[model samples]
Target: MLSQFKTPLLLLSSLALCACSAVTQLSSTQSDATITIKEGKHSGNPRSETLKTTSFGNYEFKVEQPQGKVLYGVLPLKFNGGYLAADILFFAPAAFFNLREVYPYYEFDTEKGVVRYKNKPQDSWLEYAPLAAESERAKAYFNAKP
Candidate 1:
């Protein structure tokens, strides 16, 4: 009797454990600005992305303004205790997966070419120095055109 339900229960538990994901919400002051994930399985606007927690690593992304200014950033994978506990109690394979500790919301500053997160003022995830000169050049070029 118990044996008949054991396999089904195991399969169900395994499926549930492997479905771990993290949600990242993105926004910008300029509605025309575009957000793109350069690395990992994500692409298109960063407005909202469901990242697979099982794949652990950095998710590099960029924000591009209409004038061609691009701001690069990285979203790293983080550990989730709840997922770990569930993995330990149910599926052992899921223990190896990692979760992304993303800010609930991200706002892109088009003018300053910066990406800011909610509640975190001092810390910025964007790589500002490398692209600063390029952005300036782009702005200058666009301004000169008209």
Candidate 2:
């Protein structure tokens, strides 16, 4: 009876671990394969609650790793769809930075533009400057169906 209980608990823990999203950037070895970032708005519905510019640099991505919650983190998506946050922090998870200006959490997809930040899943931001450049093998990371 005890063994049966242990097995169920272990399985539950494993499932929970897999459910969490991994916030990672490309390393040279795998750079050519993880094309989460790209140039221009080809398909993704990039959005903004307060602003939009003639260029894409003025936008950021609120990437939620887990599906059912408010954004727990922010990701900067620059012009040509290059990931500015990954560029800015160089894949440094926001938890370490403790940046107030960069509101650790955000929900641009909500009915109210601005709300108290919450750690739901994923959130992102954007800014102008010398942002991170797309990796040499950045193109390989896309889900190519075409």
Candidate 3:
């Protein structure tokens, strides 16, 4: 009776919690841009990747330039609406934390000859700079291009 329903209810709750996250992929046109993770997995620029996760977390990746410059940065994959709703509705205590921004940003500085993650230009050129309009514009621009 009650005991029999407990296991199923827990399983369902776990599934509901983990299903909050959504997948998104990003890419760049620079041929030299490559990504390498700590696990030694190598990927050719972020092109058509299917990123899926259950928790809001950040992963460190190094972007390599053709000129041999290694740019270390964090690519932030924010929590989708479902994740937020799930946290607020069921995990109210965890909702106290801001899980939206899970990583730092990176920007390239030409004059200093370095890629910076702390200082940013007033006019940033990063493809995904966290602006809704800009992100959509970049997506449209890239999709429109050959």
Alpha carbon lDDT of each predicted model:
0.59, 0.28, 0.45
What tens-digit string does per-residue lDDT give for candidate 3 at 1-146?
69998997898688565553333333334455665432223465553333334253444445566786544444544555555676687665554443443213344332233333321235354343333443344345434545
> TM per model?
0.58, 0.22, 0.43
> For model 1, where is the 10-residue window of minimal lDDT?
37-46
On TM-score, the leading prediction is 1
User: How much does each candidate deviate from the true structure in C-alpha RMSD?
Assistant: 8.2, 16.5, 12.2
Rank the candidate models, highest lDDT first.
1, 3, 2
Candidate rank order under TM-score = 1, 3, 2
- Candidate 1 lDDT tens digits, 48-84: 7766665455545566777987666554344567666
Evaluate residue 135 in candidate 1 and report its C-alpha lDDT on the 0 to 100 scale. Answer: 49
Superposed by TM-score, candidate 1 places the C-alpha of residue 13 at a distance from the truth, in angstroms, of: 3.3
Candidate with more favorable, higher lDDT: 1 or 2: 1
Model 1: lDDT to the true structure:
0.59
Task: Show where candidate 2 strays beyond 4 Å.
Answer: 3-11, 14-42, 46-135, 139-146
Cα error, residue 58 of model 1, in Å, equals: 1.2
